[model samples]
Target: MNSATPLLEVEGLRKSFAGVHAVDNMSFSVAHNTITGVIGPNGSGKSTTIDCISGFQRPNAGRIRLDGRDITRLTPQKIAKAGLIRTFQTVHIYEAMTLRENLLQAARPFQASGWVADFLRLPGMRREVDAAMVRADELVDMIGLRKYYDAPTRILSYGQKKLVALAAGLMPKPRLLVLDEPVAGVNPTRIREIEEVILNLHAAGESFIIVEHNVEFVMRLCERVIVFVGGSKMTEGDPKSVQQDARVLEAYLGIPA
Candidate 1:
């Protein structure tokens, strides 16, 4: 693990609404090629924190860095270009678009094709399309949604839609992917599948910051787990240690023992 420079870092982040602080002086870091899990109860600021990181919502105060460059106030599009991608708790997929089309669209921003080239059907545009198609195929298969590659996403189940969103995020091959509640409403079997998909991606050198409500899922999947309570980071450590923390049990996650 590269300890000198983290892949992503957030320090002294603060967000508020109507005089209520959703995240107060939040701070953390995610190293390259490692998965870090963030867990907290409702209103603990897990989602709010990620929103700020991903540029969905601006923070009242803080610093966010990606690969040592500040991205605290950058737009979401700019942030994605800097190698950070995020998936929402609610699956965000084009219901009428074919799964393959959805994935390709997500990758368009990173492709070499310009608007002029695409409009003119230039060779560069075609080449980029071919490359994106290849990546789409790989991601679709990884998510076990190959059969739905040509099907409209609206026909998929809720869990299946979540998988599509995950795949779309991977199409960009981001430096860090933040997943918000990856398995929130998923069934046990679907959750297991999602776990396998994440493991496969991790083995291939992807880094992630997963903000999930499922304590067991986070514990089972992440190497390090950070617990949040009442909008601030309570503690962070290995999964086992975080799971056994008395404060975490009594406050957020229920006692496991």
Candidate 2:
């Protein structure tokens, strides 16, 4: 919460399954309002690291700080409530629901109304609904999904559905958004659109930690890149420097040293 503190920090993070270390003493920090990318090869602990940070998996030993507050042992729901939102590798939109409904549902947890109020349609509930709708409208427009606002998400293309998911994540205006493989299955053109959307959002004061297998995409979007190898941070620097590092080539890209 100090102006100079990193938005998120992980210190000596370590996790293992049956004695096999997934993230071994990894330490990293994501600066506020900056796009940071994490890239690694197979079995390099990328998945486990994010899982620990996001609270899906607890670390055997480590500390995770968000907004300069310790959140290392919080539950997934608690962590989400703390404003560290993470999207999955797969699309998470509700196919049967309209695009508008999906975005509104994403904010249900933050509405400050109890189920009794919601069921009875109380004044507070109604006011929250109106406010959520305004946010939904802004986000739908931002993601360029306004035309499909009332339409069921089931009919949208895979790329379009992904966009809907992105918009839903923004509905809460989280302190930091951790994107997991956002462009993994998206097409080339859609990838560019996603990139532009991220840049626009960053310009508007949003920060992100992107975990992606697509090195080229990460290089284009992130200000700093961290390469993981042997379950720890192998090297970290600007995209150009990380890309040219021989260790990254040998360890991540599978090119012989």
Candidate 3:
């Protein structure tokens, strides 16, 4: 792709369930190495948009492209392999596993070992396992979970589990990371930590598309914001401009601009 190409593009996207449109003619583009936020009221199709982009729900019409490659028909696993990773609003950690183990599992998709070799513990498999472990350790430290590295995920607080989920999404070093409600249910202190992690990652050349309800958090973190209302694009701009938009204010706060 050329330097001018967007990292991700959703054009004329539409999805409906049981004759009700969830995402209707939505279109947006996320630039490379930038953080973009999507926000709207409940039932406005925010989650549905994420689901379509991530390949969890196939769109009935429209196209999705990553790095200029059409991916609308791809499966979720294929899309992930093509360098888009996403996290859900709910934490998806394995409660029985240690923090380190959870990270290792996250890295498994990128590991080079075949199942047969892994079952036999061949030399190559051992090396792959070692590499995965090193990566897990690094991620543990990066997300401030080093203290809980050996502890079961079930023992961590809700906020800590969110951090773990974020770390897992980073394991593949995706070109675009889609975060859905990343700060939901997290404590104030953990929220700050999550913010720091996002900033640090973006500084390190990562791109993100965040779907969140915390307007203030979105304003503070995202370089661009997209507003959705009733399953379609309402307005989009930098944080200040979007916040100042009359339609956005009316939609979000029910106040006239």
Candidate 4:
């Protein structure tokens, strides 16, 4: 890929369920090593757009490119293997597993060997598992979950679970991480923690596309913001300009700019 090429691009994207259009003629791009925010009113197709981009839902018409290669028709698993991973609004962690175990499972997808080696516990497989454990511990420490490393995920608070999910998404070292509402229901402190994690990751050269309803949070976190209304892009710009746009304020915040 060229240095100037976008990390991810969506062109003329469209999706519909039954007769209702969810994402209509949407288009955007996420640059490398940048945090881009997507915000809109309810039913404005924010989630739908993400689903299409991440391969959770197939678009009726559009082109999706990752690192300059077409990935519009790839399966979710294939797309993930291609270094694009996403996390949902609901934290999806193994309730009965420890944080370390959860992180290990997330790393399983990137394992070079097949399950046959893992099942047999071969020397190479054991070495791989050990290395994965070390990586998991590093991730746990990075996300500030080292204190609960051995605790069952069920015992952690909701916000902590969100952190675990975020860390899990990073386990594969994806080029782009699509986060769906990273701090939707967390407390203020946890929200700040999540924000800090995002900023830290961005600083470390990870790219992100954040879909959030928290306008203030988006303003504080994202460099570029895209506003959606009626299943299409209303406007896009820097955080300040997007927030100050009359169309964005009216369509997204239900207030005049």
Best by lDDT: 2
C-alpha positional error of residue 229 in candidate 1 after TM-score superposition, expressed in Å? 1.1
Model 1 misplaced stretches (Cα beyond 4 Å) = 1-3, 254-257
Residue pairs whose backbone atoms clash in candidate 1: none
Candidate 2 residue lDDT tens string, 1-257: 68789899999999999999988989999999999999999889988998999999999999999989999999988998999998888888899999999999999998799989988999999999999999998888888888999999999998898898888888899999988889988999999999999999999999999999989999999999999998999999999999899989999877987
Number of clashes in every candidate structure? 0, 0, 0, 0
Candidates 1 and 3 compared by lDDT, better number: 1
Which one wins by lDDT: 1 or 2?
2
What is the RMSD of candidate 3? Answer: 1.2
- Model 1 lDDT per residue over 47-104, tens place: 8998999999999999999988899999999999988999999889999999999999
Q: What TM-score fits each model?
A: 0.96, 0.97, 0.96, 0.96
The 10 consecutive residues of candidate 2 with the worst lDDT sum are 162-171
Candidate 4 lDDT by residue in tens digits, 1-257: 58799999899999999989998999988899999999999999999988888899999999999999899999999999999999998888898999988998888888887888878888888877898888787778778989999989999998899999999999888999999999899899889888888898889898999999888999999999988899988889999998778887788667865
Question: Each candidate: what lDDT?
Answer: 0.91, 0.92, 0.90, 0.90
Q: lDDT (0-100) at residue 237 of candidate 1? A: 97
Q: What is the per-residue lDDT of model 3 for residues 1-257, given as tens digits with 9 covering 90 to 100?
A: 58799999899999999999988999989899999999999989999988888899999999999999999989999899899999998888899999888888888877788889888988988887788787777778888879899999999998899899999899878899999999998888888889988999999999999999989899999999999999999989999999889999999888976
Candidate 1 local Cα displacement, residue 174, angstroms: 0.2
The C-alpha stretches of model 4 lying farther than 4 A from their native spots are: none
Model 3 accuracy (lDDT, Cα): 0.90
RMSD of each: 1.7, 1.1, 1.2, 1.3
